[model samples]
Target: MTRRTVRIAMNGVTGRMGYRQHLVRSLLALREQGGLDLGDGTTLWPEPVLVGRREHALRAIAERHGIEQWSTDLAAVLADPSVEIYFDAQVTSAREEAVRQAIAAGKHIYCEKPTGTTTVGALELARLATAAGVKHGVVQDKLFLPGLLKLRRLVEGGFFGRILSVRGEFGYWVFEGDWQSAQRPSWNYRSEDGGGIAADMFPHWEYVMHELFGPVRTVQALTATHIPQRWDEQGKPYDATADDAAYGIFELEGGIVAQINSSWAVRVDRDELVEFQVDGTQGSAVAGLRKCRAQHRSATPKPVWNPDLPATERFRDQWQEVPDNGDFDNGFKAQWELFLRHVALDEPWRWDLLAGARGVQLAELGLKSSAQGRRLEVPELSL
Candidate 1:
């Protein structure tokens, strides 16, 4: 049997997102079968090379993973004739330069979200990758999430006919490092690091909003920095500069109103990490990261305002324990597999830089709306 292997060079191999790519995604992607169900035992895999700063750190990481190759010099990695893909898990500030280097080195690129700290830089990287003729992709990881995928199915199936509105409640309190360490990385809480909930999360919403209802037409938003100060790992206080929370309302293609509240300050409400409730003229549905609870007109009671009586119940019992119908995998990991399959079978893969740029645009406009204290129209992007 002929075997194909992709030689990968991974940047930011030691940080959180990068660590996941290094230990989890790369480790799994490099394995045989890669969590795919094969009737018989067989293997499909890729070879990954560690790319990052600090030689001792890289070398130690490689030894721990039993990986043979390690490198501190990105230039050297790019110069290496064997590397086929350049993977960037670098910080937002460093992502653009890393992508440029990869494109110039003539390597296919797969990297994390936002693509760039600025919208223009993100678009430019896409252009460079296009001009360089190397395949490229951004980690639109949210779309691949199990819960959101389930939500997509419900939306596409028209479970709620003629969608009218969407309500999203997301976030949890991140520790201040005094009692417990912050759940999110320090960079995510800083403005200089290109960090902010609106910037980080609006990208996820851009596609979901587009996929579930339709493309967003306009936005009115309010952003906040709840925790003005935080302690890093060393317990030293630093001024928190990023918005920890955001409330946004968007106009979908069909005039549907979609509201999103993303925060890092609120405590979890239920077992659900995220909850989306959609109400239509015909029905309503509520979903979390996995299962969905829904009710239709047949099971609902129409009520009008009355004076002295207590209100009665309104909708059908939730669709409890409705099982998922497809293969279950972690969101980011699943995307990695899909990208690889696209590379192998030439299947249609359209999660391009355009989608990424749109995300950046949404975040930018969101901030704009907040700054101006008015609604901002979302302009269409060039395909």
Candidate 2:
């Protein structure tokens, strides 16, 4: 058995998602597990070169993680011949140019979604990656979540016979920075910085719906900036220009309708921050980040909707919990492993740059649909 190291230039590690999920949980976790076994007797180890704007932050992360390389120079990092892959978790506005540079440097690409702020930019990245013949992919981590995995299992096992509609509720209250410091960055509320609920989350809904049910044919949406004022990281008051909430109805290829309400302003009443209730002819399932519960048609309880008397039915207890048949890894790490295998061993992988473009397209169309106050058709995209 032979072991080889794959040098990955990871940008945007200073950000929350990038620092916590991608860098710490995913890549470092893989390293702790003695790297990934590549089936063909080759162990693939990841060596990440942290790239970001702030030298102090980068150095702190590198030193804390015992990572040898931390760089403020993206160009120099890209010029290094040893770097086999480039991963971006940067702000949406900054992603395209960096990715383009990575593609030009003959590096395989992997990054967070809303690959670009616009569909055109995202598609251009896809085309460039394709032309460069670099193995590329986008983070579709939600698909690998325990609940979604269970949902996929149920779907595959024909538990959800003749699947119908899907209802999703996602988001929680983000504190306005004046009184309480916001959990999310202040830039998330600024439209000029490529921030908005539609652009941020519609890409996720797109892949989730498309992969689980079918491709979206049309989209109808209404977006809102529920909170117009917030404070930045420096405690300075700023106008919140981005929409904090989005209500969307997506028409799928198989006549399935998916309605999703995404909002950062709304308080979370559901078990998870994000939950999806999928109904079908045979059964219905409600899935969150880590848990899934289902009720088959035969086991579903019938409740009277009469307001004359107090409701007595224990509706929540009716659904049976979906058992974890196997261990589930961190979704980001799981996808990273797959992408690594795809890059190293030519493994058959479906979530590529083109798929990412579709996600960006959905976001674009979603915002457009909201702006137009009408349903918009989603046309097929090509490279």
Q: Which is the leading candidate under lDDT?
A: 2
TM-score of each: 0.91, 0.99
Candidate 1 lDDT over residue span 1-383, tens digit each = 34556678888878887777545664545474553322234233667798888888888878877788888889998998888878888887888898898899998888877777778888888888888887788788777767777777777787778889999999999998777888788888899988999999998889888866789999999999999999888888899999999999999898899999999999987658888888987777787877777777676656688878876753334344445888767677777776766655655777877678888889999998999999999988774
How many clashes in each candidate?
A: 1, 0
Off by over 4 Å in 2: none
Q: Model 2 lDDT vs. the true structure?
A: 0.95
TM match of model 2 to true structure = 0.99
> CA lDDT, every prediction?
0.80, 0.95
- Per-residue lDDT tens digits for candidate 2, residues 1-383, read 78999999999999999999999999999999999999889999999999999999999999999999989999999999999999999999999999999999999999999899888999999999999999999999999999999999999899989989999999999999988999999888999999999999999999999999999999999999999999999999999999999999999998999999999999888999999999999999999999999999999887868999988887899999999999999999999999999999898999998999999999899889888899999998999
Candidate 2 weakest ten by summed lDDT: 300-309
Task: Specify the poorest-scoring 10-residue window by lDDT in model 1.
Answer: 35-44
